[model samples]
Target chain A: MKYLFSVLVENHAGVLARVSQLFSARGFNITSLTVGETEDSTISRMTIAVDGDERVMDQVKKQLNKLIDVIKVVDLTNVPQVERELVLLKVNATRQTRSEIIEIVDVFRSKIVHVASNELIIEAVGHMIKIDALIKMLKPYGIKELARTGQVCMARTE
Target chain B: MKKTGSEIIIDTLLDEGVDTIFGYPGGSVISLFDTLYNFSDKINFYLVRHEQAAAHAADGYARSSGKTGVCIATSGPGATNLVTGLATAYMDSVPMVAITGQVASKMIGNDAFQEVNITGITYPITKHNYLVKDVKDLHRVIKEAFFIARTGRPGPVLIDVPSDVQKASCEFKKITNVEMRSYNPTIKGNIKQIQKAVQMILHAKKPIIYAGNGVIISGSQNELKEFVEKSGIPVTMTLLGLGGIPTDHPLSLSMLGMHGTAYANRAIQESDLIISVGARFDDRVTGKLDEFAPHAKIIHIDIDPTSISKSVNVDLPIVGDAKGVLKELNKIIKKCDIKNWVDYVSDLKKKYPLSYTKSDKVIKPQFVIETLYDLTKGDAIIVTEVGQHQMWTAQFYKFQKARSLLSSGGLGTMGYGFPAAMGAQVCNPDKLVVDIAGDGSTQMNIQELATVANYQIPVKVLILNNGYLGMVRQWQDLFFDKRYAGTCLGRQKNCKPVCAGPDKKCPDMIPDFKKVAEAYSVKGYRVDDPKDVKSVLKEVISIKEPVVVDFRIEQEENVLPMVPAGAPLDKMLEHGLS
Candidate 1:
């Protein structure tokens, strides 16, 4: 099962190495990771997507929690959540196909962030399904490049 | 004044009251070393031949002194060199803070020359580690590293500072508190478990107490004594457990394992109840898991849960601090009588007391160890390098005090003695420290002789010189049809074309250990007479400076009470011939 976890750690050098070291050491597969300072300047929030058995993830949590710098860990899975994945797709756009691409983008509520003589950059933010659908529609137009920020999720309500 | 990372690192070390650091210099750490050079007037540094030596030396310093020892290295290979030492400190729970320089931040992930993931490599072993990317975090990280290293069930911590971080300037701020939620180390034993353990000790008819490294690590000697005396249970310690109780105590059986006293091994085998405290039933002690103490209802107490019943079955397992557990065990066992049990075991100890025969009447390694124990009266801290010398020291030396015998128990690494002895001495400077080393093993870290001399640390080195690799030869003699293949450590392997000693050209080069000692300007002597060992040790220990006593013992002598690697602990063969 895949679980997304947010960990707040002391913003110190080598903290990332420590976290990645823990994951690699225990053989836990990290699908994606993003770390940045939170609203609290001293704390860095790390969003990590990991896939493993429940027991292995539990071990990961317990071991990671043992680090002195790691302050807290929250599993964001199964919470009434708004999960978002941001992806940028660049595709070959000819004058004939430009209108067709715009029609496809309108259905998915994505925006064209950039345009050039030969290409158009389509930016989309939604769940994995919404992003995958956009990619499928653009694939026929010869997608030049694809980059996706792996799943980042937040709780739905106050 | 705005402090650089280099200054912050030194200032924190100074605040921690660290007086000594073991290290060698290189380019990445030069600025830090430069700062150290400025502070050299106050702090002492021991320049070692190898960074590994510095690590082990720091380990030795910490284990003995009960303080966090420090070591430093340059980037890349210098940092990697510290890995073995850091792991050693980590395994033995010695408090050490290893400082290493890294390439500049921009150069880190670039795989630039002289860059390695030192912090990454040490994650599993270190209690905690830090990398100082900026000067601002230096003071806090250094303080935190020391606090974590020495606080509870102490272990090594590493701080990797990039070259830029070390040189970068920032304001100095003192950290008064560190809030760590997940890093809480339990300091107290569980009351319920303690009471249960006490009940088990108090009610048992034939209880044999087994002590391990935990007893010394937790400083639970007094509690151990009270429980043993109150319950009248005889105590037998593992190799790591030596000195938890006085050797001459009626209840104390020196050590229990393959070559353990016949009585201690048999006592556990026959006991109705066994209270094993602070020890994991290592294969050395539990020979054949099924046959080991089958009759005994076992109560195992240890701090680490993974250690309990991991190898042998246990009737009761308690996880908590050894000292806390001992205190509770003492409270519950107010009074008890095991006169018969004590008497029976006492008889076994007296009759077959650990004794060996030296057929040539030459000074035996056992003789040197026994005499050393007698001379020091077991008050000296005895550290040993691994292999035959380690086992021999365990068997022959009587440890009458706790934390007095330090050796590589789990890892059993060779060259552990000299550096570990240094650590032990650093912990308790008032006490004498001795490193019992073998010729081959000592050579591995023999370079520390300069460190000892430089610091004027009075750590005595007793080299048990035999021509061949004794332990391997013993196995070969017993199991390999005496082929002696790859076991002979004679000069034939690398004979000297010409000798350098008083005698002219000789076929062999026996590591002029005395000359090696003298080269360091330390006192040295070779004891060729077995009869003179006692007086020599007595006279040597009287000296204030570090000295090496190269006692030449019989060549083929093997340590007894052999369980032959794969054999069950219960079925240990007492002697090679037997």
Candidate 2:
């Protein structure tokens, strides 16, 4: 199971590394990790995605919550979460396949970010599954390049 | 973003998840103490009789609870007093954070009355230490110190807060995270190395697994057992490694050192392959390195890289977490033929097992310890005091699980048992917690009986009442001519004299342990007869409240299988392979 947690922590050097290190040292698999300053300059919000059993996830949450710097830990995995993943994929599209690729991108509401004589760069923003499926579809079309902004999630109501 | 000193210190502690601190009040740390008092409702403070006890209590809490233990002390003597406790935690790798009060900024290094460079003194033992000179940096320094203490190979970390800094006000900003490039702990085991280890185990005809404290510290008992079960290797544990494998398990050989089982010693000597996990080849275990497991091809696994090849040489050294490495090794070891190796080790066990002779002259400490095993069946956790009693308990008591035998193994702290037992009981309330102490060692921390009584902590204490310092006597008996020196309890310094005859006027100062227990309003039982010792221990441990049993025994009994000072493991006498 995957868990997405947004933690509010005191802004101090090494705090981010501390969380990541805990994950790495414990052998917890992290699918995505994003950190940035919050509205309060003194506080930083970190979104971490981890895969583990329920018990392990619970322990992880409690352990992270026990850190003195952590003000609050909000698990956004189940609470009507707004999850977004951005991908920039360059696919080989000659004259024969260019029109078909454009039609597929239009169906997914993606935009053509860049275009060359034999390649097309498509940018899409959605949930993890959508990005994964898009990557799979583009693989058949010969993906020339790929980059993904690992999952960043927030509470839907907030 | 900057904060004042006092708030920052509290914030850092809060960040470190410290809810309880054991400490003593003093001059230099008055401000910190005052702040602590104000925050009393939120952060708990346990007042201790001495600074040393505070440290031990913290260590006890950390060991059982699996959280960083916190202790606070004032400057100079208070700080110095904590050295023993810090060293104990450091040696055992307990996660602890010590807060000390330093002299005022201007007063420091002026030959200030209460000022001492605590950080310098604790440098060698601590995982890391800091002296917070500036108030603004207090919070960050404390947060970072806590981070270092509890992470990687966990150990104690100290922070000396100047008195003035505790008074200086700062903003209450907390540090939520910490990142240090040089501090990353290695997590993954090298696949190639693990595969090689598997291959060695498969081909070896006679292989034995030498387990150590590393298995317990890494929390990898399951992994160790899995590896052993799959590889069919016989396992021998060190004194500290006793509980890493269930002692009753068919392949489990209780301990492998000075007093290790005969089968374990023979297995190590004759085995073709040796797998040492999370244990250093201490002189006690490897008497003469050249003769120690000379026939075995050694494979050493530990989280600390330096531990590899430090004492005995290693053919295959895997540098990673014991649990992680064992997990990887288990996967690869699944396809191996270790049946012959297992049978060879089992044959050794059948030939020369761990059996002791019952003495006809006096009550042996080993017998009393074995009684503890009979009563508890190695189910309860056993804590012990230093001196001959500690070694005897390690030799005689059978430990069936890890974290079950909590003693001052590395520091050999004499007064450890009573308080440590009390602490262990706090963590394991339902399980029976017993402390086995020598007469000399028990008196060192007997004051903690009050703590045990006050908390209503049902800790069973078995004081092996041998009137002399037994270990010292053993050394004298071995090295010096049997002309007794000051090792006797009737010495002038101790202000006591034995009643030898009717005419002899004995010193009026012998304190009866039963009376002492009565004074504390705790139950006391005395076993004068050797025959009744086992029944008395069973009754005491079975009770619902704290019970102390003083079993007076022969004075000169020594812990056998001892290697003389600077002797090698294979050179151990009294007991070993034929």
Candidate 3:
């Protein structure tokens, strides 16, 4: 099963490394991790996606909470949550295929961030499923480069 | 008052009631050492030969005294060396605070000399770790480190201070109180859960108490004894729980698990109820999990909630400090009339008593340990290197008090005992401290002899000098058809695969331990004759200096009453190839 944890930690050096190390050393697989500074500069928020059974996920949550830098950890998997990911893909394009690519980008509500003579850099932001779908659609155009800002998640307000 | 980070560290340590520190000096920590020089009257710092030994020594000190052990080292390699020791303490839940000097703040991440991300590296191993970014935070960090290290399910904590921070001056304010909202640990068991546990105990007909290192960690030995006596239950200890109850007690089954006693294993197998206190059902203790104590209803009392139901399912789980929970349990539980169950366990004990061959020509390892036990009257603090010798010592040495038997239980780390013995000896100079070590394990951290000789610590190192890595050799002998692949420690380069037995001629042992001891300027003795065991042990124990006694025991011996991996505890091999 996939579990998502929203962890708020002290914005300190090596905090990210510590979180990643905890997962790796304990043999817990991390599907995706996104860390960024919160409104308060001294605090950082991390959205970690992990794959494990209930027992393993429980251990991961407990171990993460045990870290000194971590202030709070919330398992957002079972909760009503909103998750988003951003992907930037550079695809090879010819004059003939450029119109087709733009039409597909319009249908997905994505933007052509950069356009070159033979390449188009497409930027997409949505839930993980949508981002993955857009990437899958662009795969046949010969992806020149790709980068993803792993999933960031939040609990839905009641 | 204004003080440097170094001064704040010293003042805080003194305020925490820390009198001794184990450490090694390096460039990054030179300022801290210099500051320590001025406070020699308040602190006694033992300079270890290696940083790793410093950590082990501190762990030993912590386990023996129930105080948070302190060790310090420089950044990079020095800090890295402490990893194994920290991991060992972490696994066993020993309370220790390790202070390491990091590179200057500006130099961090620039790959400067002596720079390492120690805080990041020790994250998984430590209960909590801090990197002192500002000198003002030094005092608070030190206090938190000690508090976290000593409180609830204690484990190692690391504080990494950059060199610049140690030298930087800040307005020092003494922290008289520390309250971390996110870090409060549960001290008392839930009332409903405790009631459930008591109910389970009352209903149980054949009940057993399984104890572990937490009993020693919480200093709840008396509470545990009272609870067991009131409940009239048989007690079985883990390796770290050896001294939780007197080994010779009528209801005491010394140890249980892979290398545990036959009767103890049999009782665990047949018991209807198991009351586990402070013990995490480790894989070593639970063989073939599905078949482990299938008939038993488990009531687990542990300080750490995660440890409960982590390995084995439980009928009832009480999360609280062992001492607190046991006190509550003793107050509520009544004496049970389970004479039939008690008699059945006693019969099992009598039937499968621990025994070994009485050899006249060769000294068995068990005999050597028994002699040591007899000479010390089970009073000496026994530390051990992991292997056959460690198990034998745990089996033969009857520990009558908590914190008397200290070993790397969870990690099963080799080369832990020698330095650990030194640490224990330093803390208890008036008491005897001995490291019962194996030939292979002794060689791993043998350089600690220099530290012992330099400090004049009266620690005894008893090396059971079997020619092979005895435990692995035993496995190869049993399961691998005696192939002896890479298990022989002293095999000659040109020696035949099928070497002659001990009765015939065989290659001599390498790096003779007596000579190795002599090289470190310590007294050394070698005893090959079985008759010399008692006298040699007595002479060494009487010595006022660190001494090494090499006992050339029978080479083909293996620890018996052994339950093979993934096998049921009831199925034990009583003898070697019997």
For every model in order, the fraction of real contacts preserved is: 0.38, 0.00, 0.43
All candidates: DockQ? 0.24, 0.01, 0.45
User: What DockQ was computed for model 2?
Assistant: 0.01
lDDT of each: 0.81, 0.78, 0.90
Better of 1 and 2 by lDDT: 1
Candidate 2, superposed: residue stretches over 4 Å from native: A1-158, B1-4, B335-341, B359-362, B492-509, B575-578
How much does each candidate deviate from the true structure in C-alpha RMSD? Answer: 6.0, 17.1, 2.5
Native-to-model Cα distance after best TM-score fit, residue B372 in candidate 2, in Å: 2.1
Q: Give per-residue lDDT, candidate 2, residue B69.
A: 87
Top candidate, metric DockQ: 3
> After superposition, which runs of candidate 3 have C-alpha atoms over 4 Å from their true positions?
A87-125, A133-147, B518-521
Model 2 agreement with the true structure over B1-578: per-residue lDDT tens digits: 65557657776777677887778889988877777777877786767677887888788777766688899999999999999999998887788999999999889888798889887777666776777877877877787788777766778989998888888875566567877543565557678888898888888878888988788878899999898888777898987787899887898977877666667876788788888898888777886777787778989887665566766778998878888999888777764566666677778678766555687456777889988898889888888888888887877777777888877877778887776677667656798888888888888877777777776878888888877777887777766765456676645553434322212343432457888888888899877777887778867877999988887776666667666666645565664223
Q: For candidate 2, what is the lDDT?
A: 0.78
Q: Residue A82, candidate 1: how far off, in angstroms?
A: 15
lDDT of 1 at B136: 88
